[model samples]
Target: MDAEQSIADEPEVTEKRGLFGRNKLATSEPKPAKTLGPLKMIWAELAKYPGKVALAFIALVITAAATLAIPAGFKLIIDNGFAAGGNPDDIGRWFRYLLMIVGVLAVGTALRFYFVSWLGERVVADIRLKVQDNLLRLAPGFYEENSPSEISSRMTADTSLIEQVVGTTVSVALRNILMGIGGTIFLFWLAPGLTVGLVIAIPLIILPIMYFSRRVRNISRSSQDRVADVGSMVSETLGAMKVVQAFNQESREKTRFEGAVEAIFDTAKKRILLRALMTSIIILFIFGSITLIMWRGALGVSTGEISGGTIFAFVVTGGLVAGAFGALTEVYGDLLRGAGAASRLNELLKAKPSIAPPERPQTLPLPPRGSLSFRNVTFRYPTRLETAALKDFNLEVEPGETVAIVGPSGGGKSTIFQLVERFYDPQAGTIRIDGVPLASADPAEIRKRIALVPQDGVLFSSNARDNLRYGNWDASDEDIWEAARAANAESFLRDLPDGLDTYLGESGTRLSGGQQQRIAIARALLRDSPILLLDEATSALDAESEQLVQQALDNLMQNRTTLVIAHRLATVRSADRIVVLEKGQIVEQGTHRELAAANGLYSRLAALQFTSSDAA
Candidate 1:
């Protein structure tokens, strides 16, 4: 089965490589080691919108400056405007000036938010598009080793975290840094001795907080992981509800979900407790230092060593500095999280497709003859390197010829289709379409001449029209109807509520297994490719549906080159030639009557199948 189908069938907790190559629970967020270097990718994206970035930066500076000016404005109102002999006009002027600064602060802060948020959303949108584009270029082998579920989570959860970093965290960090620096300078100007004392106390306050914050962060990560665990369990249980009910295991499932929820609650409780302790410690240190500073300032006021306005400004600015630094402590952790997200996203963005067009690709011959040849091909799937799927296999099919490949389960019947599509290059072979080597031509060009009907019909979540037209996007409604009629899908297609416009639902769940297979056949008919591949195309259909579809396929195969993989020996009786594969090698090849008479492997398989059919 494909990776996506496997993940859907069994939604178990798996492990994926973390940011630094260590395996971790897939549900947990990736953690970055010591550096935020991956943020450079975000910067690269941000650089695309220079005007918006510049505007945000300018507004950020204005807001920070306005914030610092507030304390100075208050000091002027107190020392000059509120003095004993001050005129009412002087008081009014200072108050108006302070109000003006507030106006600028409000406008600048709004502008900063708007511009920063725009840049964040734009950058994320671009990254997602680029990542998806690269993902499309990747070969199927990549999906074999990586879970689509984990990759999907990175695409969504990781990108959303990046959006937060761009929109909120980075802006807050920059603004707070400016405020912290500006506030500290102002504090020193107001009272040098007091500023030195505050600076010394700053480390003592921050060091303990930092240590506590580290513990809190770790607990918070664990808490989030537990919540993710709960979410995964809920999804798994709901997805398999039918199986659970059939097995009378609803009570077991309930207990399992309850256990998951309690685990989440327990982790949350620890995080909350740590955060509460941290908050209490922060309050004691911050307020205690403020009290000491206030007492010293009070003595200075009594001795007339400094004015009331100066001490007041000093105290206010000191609070602003402390708050700024505290906000900064949280910023680093957020940046680290963003860095982890960026690293994972970068991995996707930077991935080079293993199967790609060469620098100079050879164009396939015009007016395709659909002739395909496998010359001494030896191939192995990347995941199974030790076992060759095809060992020195050779085959040649001319235009307008039908070749049926009959095989047991692991006999390399499907590998031929994969090689013909150029999804992977064989380890030792030259596969050619119309005399053009696959490796020398673009994969798109190679696949354009081929059509495939898989054992299971795969459909997208869309209207029937779209699903049918997927094989040939430009096919007209009339063309689609003709193909549907040929595939015996016209009656069912017209019976739907909205006809062609009815939503097919995910994977065409609205259609029956036989109906879905017919739709798949109709799609291939619409493709009008010269080379057709049918991998148990009628496997899901009933006897009648199979017979009708087989007649349609026979008509379609008359002029096209066809390769059929059929386990039902009866289906290949009319083929020009039948090749029976065993363990990656063709053990016998002949007409049905000839092979059956020879009493070889093909004869044995045919005897067993025919006997089973007779018994039924």
Candidate 2:
């Protein structure tokens, strides 16, 4: 089985790595270390959009200033127009003040909405583009260990948290800061004595907000992490619906999913409760301060030290300060939550791909007709420890020479293809092409010279023409048709309603196994690379298709340096040289007739299936 199919055969949690392949996290090791916060890293990322952020911040300040000014207008109308013995013209002045306040608010509100929304959209788009670029740059080995679902969930769900920071929280924070500061100044201006009484309350309120803000941030991050777990579960289950039904495990799988969902709900409920408590505490503090100031203002009015109008103005200004500060506390909680998400996204952004191209590497020549060699090569899989996949293995293939590797399941047959493709570097020796080390060669440049048709012939959900053209993006219509003919797929393709334009529904499920394999071979032929690796290309085909497809493959392999890994004895019967592997060692090497006469592992394997007629 191929790596992806092998993963699909296991339990959903165990199988998650292949379909959405990712590295499994073990509790034995420490959990992923959390980055310290209030993270300045977020500011560093946000700094990339300084122009938009600055404009949004300015708009928020203006809006808050407008909101604070409204209460001042009320104070003026009460003290100057409603006071005993006030001039009748004062009413007209108050009317003009109210209209100016409303106009300022309207403009400020509109500017804040426009700028913040634009910034949010732009930042998220940039982040997604950067993520895709990074994933493209990663080598296959990196993906072999990491689940695709984990990466996808982080990219889609985790980055969404940053939207609030870019579009809403940023502006809200600025507005609240301005409102709090502006309201405090107005309060001092109207009644310095009352401002002194409320001064003590400000610290009491601020201290709790600061403490709870950090707690909320930690909890929100924990909540989002649980959400990612559920996403991983759902992605794995949906991808393996076939197996779930085959085994009649639908009820068991549903119950497992429900458990995951319930865990998420528990975490989310905690987050919601914390947010609610914080908002309520802030509200109570504001109202308590407001009550005390009102009582004091009433006493002053009755003593005749302050007029009823002055008492009214004092109450208006005090209420404004209290309300502004209270709202500031609420908005601050949202900022904390957004900050948590920003931290998660920023972690992914900072992750470096394990494989990277050399800074000053030589470019590979087009149509690389160069010698390939492995000298004492050795490699171990990430998860296994009993033995290496390839140990002290050595081979040399001259340009245009076709060599086939034949072995039992764990005899290191596939490892030869993997190393030749440079998916994993050998631990003990060197791999070179044309005297240039594979390690020093640019990964993209190296891959360009080789084509691999993996055992499963994996297909994408795309039209036949587009899928075939993926082999060579610059290929013409004739080139595609010719390649398809060479793979023995032209006949079936022509019978389809739209031929090359026909959509191959999700992974080519509409086609039979043999047809899909032929399409994959067509893709490889279109690539027209110097080195070709076929891992049992005809293993999944029936006798009829295999015979027809074998003729096409013979033509495709004629001038290329081919490395074939096969279990079927008949496929390798005509190979120029066959290397028989046993426990990562090459036990025998020769032509089919020579090896069979020797009566060794090769003879036994041949006796199993390689009759003269089958070979023909």
Candidate 3:
């Protein structure tokens, strides 16, 4: 066997593996999330805590009532304290009434704060959990169009906005609305003529409010999108920092990040400027109308059309109404912003993954024997529908047999593994395992019968034991060590200070490429599925490590149906049958000796490898 019989005769396997590995598992599009009005969705979330919501509303009502009663208390203090027959006891009793109302106001305000704040925190937590769970269940195809960074931003920034609206802003708006209505009623009773003067300027205030409401909503939505863009840039750049530095692209990344930040600033500036202009207009109209109305009330008191106390009560009550009206504008802006956040979260929750179990899914065959067949399978990635990844491909594998698929890049090698795993249903074909068509079986049931080790060794930021246990969550410690030993990974795992408890950093950065691949193989071994799919499993390993892992693979493949996607000819020489694929079709297939004797594509590739090895 020539040394160059490996794919090292061509470009490195690692480089080719990267290109072929992408877009392999393209699932069907998920069900579109329902587009619900933001307020309606928020109400549904709040409805989950009916008792708390009731208590909060009751507290809010009491607080508003207390504020309204204060103006009445002032009237009593003025009228009774200085009555024509002015009894000393009566004056003292009126003061006592005022003090009692204040006490009620204090308790109600505190209760309102506690209940609303608690509700806000609780509701936001529930929303975040729902979004997270739904995201996990969504098809991987969703990530092709949407960035993880943007999704994360919605979970953090958008949820925070919802919390503020739910906790404090909602109660504040309701209270102000109550105050405005109560104050208006009292104003008309106290001095009807002056009340009429204040109502006339309502049109002036309403016009500006309408203008700001539309602009704030549109601008706020854009502002949020811009912020998410900034988050996406930061996440993408940081995750790829190694590549960025290796290519000396730090300055370019910084410039890209700065552009994202400036986009956010520009959007925010428009929103803030509109809010400021609206606030200025509201203040001018509210206090301007109050000044003119109160001047007439003072004149009425001098002429005897109204008493001195009545004039004071009218002016004070009118001031309360104007202040409440002003606050309503601010509250309206908050509600708008919160709506945008709620709308985003609702969309995420409503999305249903395409690969979810049918309403009445068929049960898979019991005691899997690992036989699989593909009849005229044709497929294209959901994201790349124009380009066919596999076209009318046909194959069959017997139980306990090992079949190696050898092909150039993008020859449907990885696509076969994806179809076997049922990540993406072929556009046209009948794929069966144990004589049962895949469409007739539940997706989860199909996956349980198969184990996969792709080109990359996917590892999470978790301990060694936890990562290994991911293959079979209920597996025992003894079983875990057994699988690791079988994969030739037991020695390195034993060397670590914490043994199985050693924390694997993000993506197993603590381990070398060969070590990570070994761990991946160990994970698959722990699954102990009836069928196994290995895609370039040893393509990245050094010579010494490859020899050891290859031996482990041989042991694991015993008595199991195995399909190998190999770039290196030397690795698959022992396979029971070899299939040469080109342009998504099987071009030639035979054992190593048969293909070499035929002097076909396989012979040419083998000759290149041997000649390259001889030159070295």
Question: What is each predicted model's overall lDDT from 0 to 1?
Answer: 0.85, 0.74, 0.79
- Give residue 92's error in model 3 in angstroms: 6.2
Residue-level lDDT tens digits of model 1 in 441-495: 9999888899998888889999999999999999999999999998888999999
What would the per-residue lDDT of candidate 3 be over residues 82-145, giving only the tens digit for each residue? 7646778888888799888889999999999999999999999999999999988876767765
Q: Assess the local accuracy of residue 436 in candidate 2 as a C-alpha lDDT between 0 and 100.
A: 77
**Model 2 lDDT on a 0 to 1 scale:** 0.74
Ten-residue segment with the worst summed lDDT in candidate 3? 11-20
Best by lDDT: 1
- The TM-score leader among the candidates is 1
Q: What is the lDDT, from 0 to 100, of the residue 53 in candidate 3?
A: 93
| Cα TM-score of candidate 2 | 0.78
Which residue pairs come into collision in candidate 3?
none
lDDT of 2 by residue, 319-341 (tens): 65655665566555456655555
Predicted structure 3: lDDT = 0.79
